[model samples]
Target: MILDVQGKAAYAYTGGKPFDASLPSTVFIHGAEHDHSVWALQTRYFAHHGFGVLAVDLPGHCRSAGPALRTVAAMADW
Candidate 1:
């Protein structure tokens, strides 16, 4: 799914489950060298059981839109 984050597009894999706002949400964020696919299997497992898993592609990475944030602090704030 595509989400709007800080006015940019953020890509998130939902592990094939339709989102249910009532379900607890879990976000799987990858490192600088990777994308959402890195957590593919894990996201699926969580989504299927009871969680709403979001395996996200950070800004400027993969399907997300961005000029990458410069530091961990920026990323965290983002």
Candidate 2:
């Protein structure tokens, strides 16, 4: 799935299911230079167990658009 965050495109893998905001959500953030695919197994498990998984590709990483966040605070805010 893709979200508009701070006017930029943010990409998230939904673990093969449509996202449901009302369900429990888990946000997965990858390490430096990585993307959402890193959490493939875990996200799939969580989603199958009734969680709304959002394994995100940070800005400028993989499918996400815009400049990379320079600070931890900024990443958290996004």
Candidate 3:
């Protein structure tokens, strides 16, 4: 599932179908220099367990558009 959160393009992936016995949502945020792809393992594992996982590459990193900088705050905002 994809969500436009206040104009920010958010990417989400789900496991199982609606009304699934396991209906849980896990939002994952990665560390600096890392993008959503970092959660590939966790996403797959959680999804296999019937949990929905939402991971996104923060702005300015990886596939997401933005800028590259050298500041803690800058990376956080990304």
**TM-score for each model:** 0.92, 0.90, 0.63
Off by over 4 Å in 3: 13-22, 68-78
Encode model 3's per-residue lDDT on 51-72: one tens digit a residue: 7667766666665554544787
Question: Of models 2 and 3, which has the larger lDDT?
Answer: 2
The clash count of every prediction, one per candidate, is 0, 0, 1
Alpha-carbon lDDT, every model: 0.89, 0.91, 0.63
Best candidate, TM-score = 1
Tens digits of lDDT, candidate 2, 6-76: 88889999998998999999999997778999999999999999999999999989999998888878787
Worst 10 residues of 2 by lDDT: 69-78
Clashing residue pairs for model 1: none
Best by lDDT: 2
Clashing pairs in 2: none
Query: Between 1 and 3, whose lDDT is larger?
Result: 1
- Ranked by lDDT, the better of candidates 1 and 2 is 2
The TM-score measured for candidate 2 stands at 0.90
